[model samples]
Target chain A: MSAVAYYLESAGIATTGISLVRENTKALRPPRFLWVTFPLGRPLGLPGDAAFQRRVVLAALALLDAPSGPVLEDYPEDVPDLPGDDVFACPVRFPPRASGRGRWGSALLEEIALLRPWYALSRERRGRTTVGVAGTLVETLAERLGALLDAPERLPGTLAELTELKRTLADLRAFHEEAVTAQPGDPPWREVRRLLWRESVLGDAMLTLRDRFDASGDPRLRAFTRVLVPRGALED
Target chain B: MVRLSDLPDYEREHLLDKNLGPLGPPAWVPPGTPLRERRVALVTTAGLHRRSDSAFDLTDASYRVLPGDLGAADLVMSHSSVNFDRSGFAEDVNLVFPIDRFRELAEDDVIGGLASNHFSFMGAGLLPEAYEASARDLARILHRDGVDTAFLTPV
Candidate 1:
């Protein structure tokens, strides 16, 4: 981001930006940047808090007034964690998984069916969903991902297939997160992420797919599979 | 709130290793006008695009145009790196793309005006310099649109 700002400023457009990583901004200093201690994704600090967001924006924009080569400022306020117990467990409990590889696919499909109502309620309530990035239906994506776990070779190695798989995994993640949040209590994303990665059937299938894809011996497939699950999840 | 030190070790290492040296020399251009008189536009690295537009590739350096009037519901994120927290974005697009806040700022005269067109790029899995040409191209568009200031954000 600092690099891009440098390019833009060089092209005669003044730029001011929020730096999530202070070290990067300090190294590749741009024309002007405001460093915030917010998490990786939330550059504006808190979500849905207009006043806090406006303050963050105004603070960053205020950097535009500086007459200098490279100016880096830090946002003063730190976003507080959500006010609630951070522990989260899925509201809907499932029977123990059937033990064989072939049965995992059926288990995944069944899980999808179980979560369908909650996902629908979530979409109706929010009037929007982040589930279509892969451009595939939820059912089809679940089935395809599940199948890859049992028969890794069944996966096609084409670019389109690779892209679809990456996005399908993403969509599935979003679908489960949305569905889980719609049930009873609203959980903090950290706990929800932990639940998705450690306790869910879909999470198991995804990790299985990641392992099989990494061992597929195709460089292109391996390259894309690395990001299928975050590094933090693996550490957990 | 989390700082770089609070991140997982691998992610912290990756971010630190992502430096592209320095882009030749630092470039500086003082704002050509007062904050209230400069036309401001948003440029994001969140890999956001309209529902009708194509999603970003794993290593794409290209950009997508987002009209100023675009709504929060019409945007979706496809950033290659899934390490960041997206719950904020799911709740409010302004957490990452702040278009609504920009609109309010414009209305309140904090900034002169909002550009008719803004830009987005998927900034992961590639070198930082890969964005140089595209950034230059976007600068031309911002220039042509009479934009004197750009507010950038990342995910």
Candidate 2:
């Protein structure tokens, strides 16, 4: 929105951005725009809920009529109590997933389980492989699961390592779960092994993938990999 | 103190002044005094999208293209998981991106002109390479159209 304001202003258009998030307003520089009250994703309103959408839209348009200056409009703080059927109930709910339904709930659970050991170890050793590992695992798992559930792509060499890492993580998670349920002897050692296995798989996969891709000079792929396995945090 | 490890490489460079090299004018611009009277163009990351373009996809780690125009009634907002839609702007929120407001401003003679083309790209990919490439391409386009200055806003 700020960009819009800047563009318009630069083009001799007096513009204002009605930001819903307050933090966004704080980050914005001057000679640009203002903020307003709306939730994160439902900027317009619950999808299909034309009434609320119209009200919000009108409120935004109202800012233009106000005298020049950044104005923060707090429309009746009546945050809608949208029902489940509400199209804009949660923006995240709308996307297509591998399962084609409620995969977000499952993904959230998996991520939490995966991060448990990483968070625990982060407290003991400051270096717990980057969060990118978790992201990579999830993406790889999703892609693989999608392939298994839908269609398979001829597996790329780089992806093979990621699939292996995902398998290793899943196995470790299953083992930890069993150990916890069974009250097995020396569970701590077992847990340590699980953590180590997870870390090693991710770390090794990342290094191999990075080396392979980096050698090719494909900036897009490199960027993708960088997000998957970020490095150089150890450097000062 | 935020650790370097806590920040991504591009972020580190942006914060630590590592990539603060000199920037010249757009490649298409002629040398000498062109910078003085250049018309400015604006591109926003506010997720200002057209009505027809697909909603920002959070799942895809790759960048997606946004629409060019969003008609009078259509709204613009980012719902992409990667997109940090912190602004409380409404879903039909044009004020934030202010495309409509810009039109009004132009009509009122507040600013001299509006760019014929504005660009928007989803901002979730962690690395800046693609964005840098897009920006360079956009700059080239703007220069080709004789845009002198550009106003950039990252949502």
Candidate 3:
């Protein structure tokens, strides 16, 4: 972000940015930035709160008025946790993974089938979705992912293959999260993430896939698989 | 939150260890227009592009131009990193893009106006040098459109 700011400022366009990572921002200090303490994905803090979001915007833009060199101011507040944010009990529970090879395909298909209604309801209620990034049908994505898991030797380890895998995983995660969060209560994002990575069958399958990648003897595959599960999720 | 200390040790260490490339001397440009008179445009590193646009790849330094009039439903995130939360953006595009909020500001005269076009880039898997050419090119476009101020956001 600071780099972009630097480029623009050098081009004679005034720039101010919302810095999520203060350490990095401080390292490459731009003309001006407001270091926000919000979560990584959310630079403007809360999701639906318009007033709070405006405050953040104004604060960052306010930096433009500062007569200084690389001003790095901090936003004063954190996003308040929502009600029932700490508690997450997934509405639909899948049976444990079957103790056999090639079961992930069928198990994932069944889980998707089970969650279909909720996913549909989520789309209907929210009027939008973040599940099409992979540009694949949810069932098709499950099958492809399962196919790869069933045979690690099939991994091409090519850029296109890696791109497809990443998109597939992103879309899959979005689908499950949307489906689960749409059921009954308002589950905070943190809990939904925990539910996806720590407790779900999908999570188990991903971890298994990571292990397969590790065993594939491909350094690139191993490196890429590190991002499949977040840090601390395995520990939890 | 992104306070380094608030993050898990591994994540914090990874971010801190990232090479930010060589830092050049800071360049300070005075605000050309007052807050209520500046034509502000959004330059995001959130990997947001229109649905009809090409999705971003791991090493893509190219940027997509988002029309200021584009609706929230039409915008989609193709960021390669799964480490950050997407639910916020899913629920409200304004969380990351803030187009609606910017529009409201323009309506209320909190800011002068918004640019006709905004820019989006994929921010992972590459160094800042990769973005230099594209950033300078986009700066020309912004300058051509009379955008004196750029509001940058990250995902």
Candidate 4:
């Protein structure tokens, strides 16, 4: 890919990239130079074939002598596409980590960060379906917490209401754990929502605690509140 | 075929002897010729490639080319997932495959000036014909540039 070439050139590696896709080359910026007009994904020729790869490499190296100018050297425009064998079929396996933790741990951490807006941006860009679902759940939780914070007067007075909220929160946590542990090909979005439900419960509890402190107005509580909440909240 | 390791330690003192056949007379150079002053170039098969370029797809096969000017800060590496800095090939990779090291030796008055460019190729191809052709072309370029010797490093 031209991106690879650009990075290498930036790294101060003397390189001239050859590719058949003209547009790919055009998209690249200056300073990291390359030669266009080679076929896609086969810069050094076909897979498992030695001679062709060598010729391509040699041709690329020869560009170094081209009078310090950056230019695209198109090979025979008429060379027909030689359908090659599938080269990427071989799967690469990584060694097991000593801690026994797998990619799932990293996935969970990513989900936690996704609960925030700035972190959500990174998660969305990864284009993973699971992340999108998790993000939606986090947004919902934030909205509920926002409403509860805005209206302490409307707080649930019954234990039944509180129990229902707590139950939903427990279910959400279960879902979050499930989503985090889901392997590839597992339905990820569903799991994300499950986790979001779990986190919302915790958010509700925190909001309730804050509201209770404000309602009590105990001297110590008021003193603590004065230190914790901004002066603007006290005025409100 | 002689195994280089099988050669007695005494005969393996020189770098050239290690490279060339030990039993044969050394390749002739002119009298007053400075081995230290010989222009040296480098070629590597580490798959050091530009992202913009097409990927080199051959297994056990590689090609060589004279690289453009590059430095450590500019390199974007991708072959293995290992960290590049830990590999300690920074200076060598930065200088386009240890040609800078050769240049350093030259600067210390140990060798001659380096060739203007060095070569690189991803070492994944299996066939030799193309590599042979490329090497021949490289040899021709070196001859044209009056290069006295070259060092090849297969990745």
Candidate 5:
């Protein structure tokens, strides 16, 4: 987005932007940017709050009048609280296996179970699905991931290995969420994304792997760790 | 109320430095006149596209055109980022793409009339080159639409 803003400004179009990730906006230092504390996907704050959303829009647009270059302002108003505070209750918590080695095979199965009904409803409505992109079944994905977790020594070492590991993780996320794209009256999308990031069995398993590799002192591994797994933080 | 302190330090550092390196200096075009007299457009990096358009590829740097007057019902978000819950956006398009807000602003002549068309791109970890081109193209659209100011929202 900083890049897009720069491009627009370079082309003689004055640009002002709202940024969810303040870091990215600060680093890029676009001509004009407003850092908002809203959730990632919902840059304008919660749904059904058109007034708030409009206020956000106006705030961003107001940056256009700044006379100088590289202006960064923080949105003054804090986002109003959600209906419920951040208890983050959900049915998809993943339990580690009996061995407790980050292998949640049964938990994966449980997630698949919890997601199936919603998956079916989504398919009925859209006549399609977001899963199956990796061209593998859910069980197969579980088994393959289990194999990887089963052998910590065989964890990704090279760039290609790390790339493959990340790809596999992507497949897992897609398969799971496309498996259940919240029914019309279901929870908000950001909540689902947050839950998946915070508590998915596979996600936690991957985090364990990331911690293991982050200790390897390999720069690439460290970088991949940040990508595949945050430093155990749920960020916007 | 949301506060910067609510975000953990690591996430702050992560955002402060995405490893993309310094983006170098941007070409600055000063707002020559009062914004109320200028033509404008609204664009987003929220991965929004029309229901009639193909969904954006997860890492796609390409952009899609959104008619300024298109119904919000016709828009949908197909994002690939893992940072936020999309449930709110899935329910309300205005959370990211505030076309309705822009339209209202236009109706009130708060700034200026909107461009003939707007734009969207799936923007997480986007390739600079691709988005550079996308921006160049967006500039053309802005030019054709006689737009002088563009408001962007990143999700």
Candidate 6:
């Protein structure tokens, strides 16, 4: 990222950047860098947290004017673990009765099946979701995902397939999130993340698949899937 | 939140230890220039692209050119880091990519004006050579856009 910043500076496009990973920014020593102690994947702050996010942006941009040899300013604000006030929950009740052969796999399939109803409910209530931004119909995409889950042995070989898989995983979480946050009395982001990645069928399925990939002796699949697997799912 | 300095030695080792070799002496162009009078643009490694555009390739270091007029609803993060939850990003993209804030700044004349197009690149797992090439390419485009100042955000 400092390379990019330095390139921008060399181009005479004065640059300043916000960094979630302070070490990387510090080592690169860009013309201007703001080290936000915010968690990875969220350099600005949290979702729906416009004011804080705006403040972070303003702070980072403020560095552009500082007399700089190489600047990595420390942002003073704290980013909460769960930054939003609105809560989320499993819209549907328990007793997911997916009829698959495997235990956790069947439960995960059940959760996947549950997504459509929850997604539609949220769409009806809020008139939108963060999922379809991928521009594919969620229902059809779900159908396509079945094959991938069934054959976790063969991971995506090309960048396109890998990207599709990543977006699909993001879509899955987004659909679940839109569904959960649709109702106002649910849990915060961390709790919801815990629910999905620590306690739910989806997390179990991912861990199971991660182990399978690791055992498959497919180094690329193992390494990449290791990265994509949710943190809580892996940790706990 | 844990201040990086307080993390366990093993846990913080990767964060504190580094040997990024020095480069050519940095050429600093002093800024006597007032920000409000310059043409400004946004550049982010936030993996942001238009709803209609193809997402960034996590492995490849290529980037997308998005129109500056895009709003919160029309942007999405195709970034592949699972370290951060997308829920916040899913709810409001400003958490990772704050183009909306840039618009507000332009309107208030805190900065000059937004360039006609903005830029985004996925910042993970890219080869160093590829990343440098794309960054240089983006620099050329920024120059063509008449952008004098860039507000960059990294996710």
TM-score of each: 0.94, 0.35, 0.95, 0.32, 0.68, 0.85
Q: Please tell me the TM-score of chain A for candidate 3.
A: 0.92
Q: Could you tell me how far off, in angstroms, the CA of residue B73 lies in candidate 5 after the best superposition?
A: 8.6
Q: Give the C-alpha miss distance for residue B54 in model 2, angstroms.
A: 12
lDDT of candidate 3 at residue A36, scale 0 to 100: 85
Best by TM-score: 3
Interface RMSD, per-candidate values to 1 decimal: 1.5, 14.7, 1.7, 22.9, 4.5, 2.9
Q: Give lDDT tens digits, candidate 3, residues B1-155.
A: 67788777788888998746545777789754689999999999999988778789866889999998897767888887767888778777888998888999999999999999999998987887778889999999999999999999998
Index of the highest-DockQ prediction:
1
- How would you encode candidate 5's per-residue C-alpha lDDT over B73-138 as one tens digit per residue? 566555555565545554566777777777788888887788989898877665555688778988
What is candidate 5's lDDT per residue for A113-216, written digit by digit as tens?
A: 77667666655754544343235576667767777766677666566565455545655775556444445443444555555657667666666667767787
What is candidate 2's lDDT per residue for A1-236, written digit by digit as tens? 43233333333333333354444343433233334344333344343344554455445444545544444455564445433222211111112222333243344345445555534443233211112212334445544433432322223345444434334333233222222222212122222323322433333333444455566566644544543333332222
Quote the lDDT for B154 in model 2: 44
- Cα lDDT tens digits, model 2, B46-105, are 444554454444322222333335453343333232212221232224423445544544
Candidate 3 wrongly placed segments (more than 4 Å): A85-87, A98-100, A183-186, B19-22
Clashes of each: 0, 18, 0, 36, 10, 3
Task: Give me the displacement of residue B142 in model 1, in angstroms.
Answer: 1.1
DockQ of each: 0.73, 0.06, 0.70, 0.02, 0.40, 0.54
lDDT of 1 by residue, B51-155 (tens): 789888877899999999987778888888878877667767888999989999889998899999999999888777899999999999999999988899988
Better model by TM-score, 4 or 5? 5
For candidate 4, the lDDT comes to 0.37
- Candidate 5 docking band: acceptable
The reply for model 2, stretches above 4 Å from the true place, is A30-34, A84-236, B1-80, B83-119, B124-155
